[model samples]
Target: MKDYMGYSIEGRTTAISTILNQYSSGITLMKQDSNGEFYPLKAKTTILPNGSKSYILTPCNQ
Candidate 1:
């Protein structure tokens, strides 16, 4: 989420889409809070029961 908040991926291996999905609505993709700060969603792609990739949003945007 820190990387997303900064908008600078200095050392990022996970895809932006993945991170977004992991965080879900808890974190904003490009929206700012009342404090005018970006809390990026921490999303990731996981293997589904059907042998497919599915996005899983984490409990929090951490």
Candidate 2:
């Protein structure tokens, strides 16, 4: 596991639900690859079928 800005992250892929459950909304999420490079996930706020809120992360065009 690695710590980034006080957030404990484990594994290469993490579920968006896990992040939203932990940090709530309006928080930017960053992903670190095996090479130790940080990348921003283009987070889009979404509402689930149950009406819960979460974020969907996609690769940034840049």
Candidate 3:
């Protein structure tokens, strides 16, 4: 076991969960912490053209 503290933590330890449930629906968003990590959101969903659905997730401004 090595030192696991602060920003030194790996992905699982440092991952951040930022989700948009209302708009995203089945989709989820994972945000990285200051250290730059990753975590699973949840799942992806596709909507039919006839269905009244819109993607809450959009391109990042930055």
Query: TM-scores across all candidates?
Result: 0.35, 0.32, 0.21
Q: Candidate 3 residues 1-61, lDDT tens each?
A: 1122134333223222222443454654555656677544432234658974322222233
Predicted structure 1: lDDT: 0.49
Worst 10 residues of 3 by lDDT: 10-19
Best by TM-score: 1
lDDT winner between candidates 1 and 2: 2
Sorted by TM-score (best first), the order is 1, 2, 3
Give the alpha-carbon lDDT of every model.
0.49, 0.53, 0.37
Q: Tell me how far the alpha carbon of residue 58 in candidate 3 is from the true structure, in angstroms, after superposition.
A: 18
The count of backbone overlaps in candidate 1 is: 7
Arrange candidates by lDDT, descending: 2, 1, 3
Which pairs clash inside model 1? 18-43, 19-43, 22-42, 22-43, 22-57, 22-58, 23-42
Give the best candidate by lDDT. Answer: 2
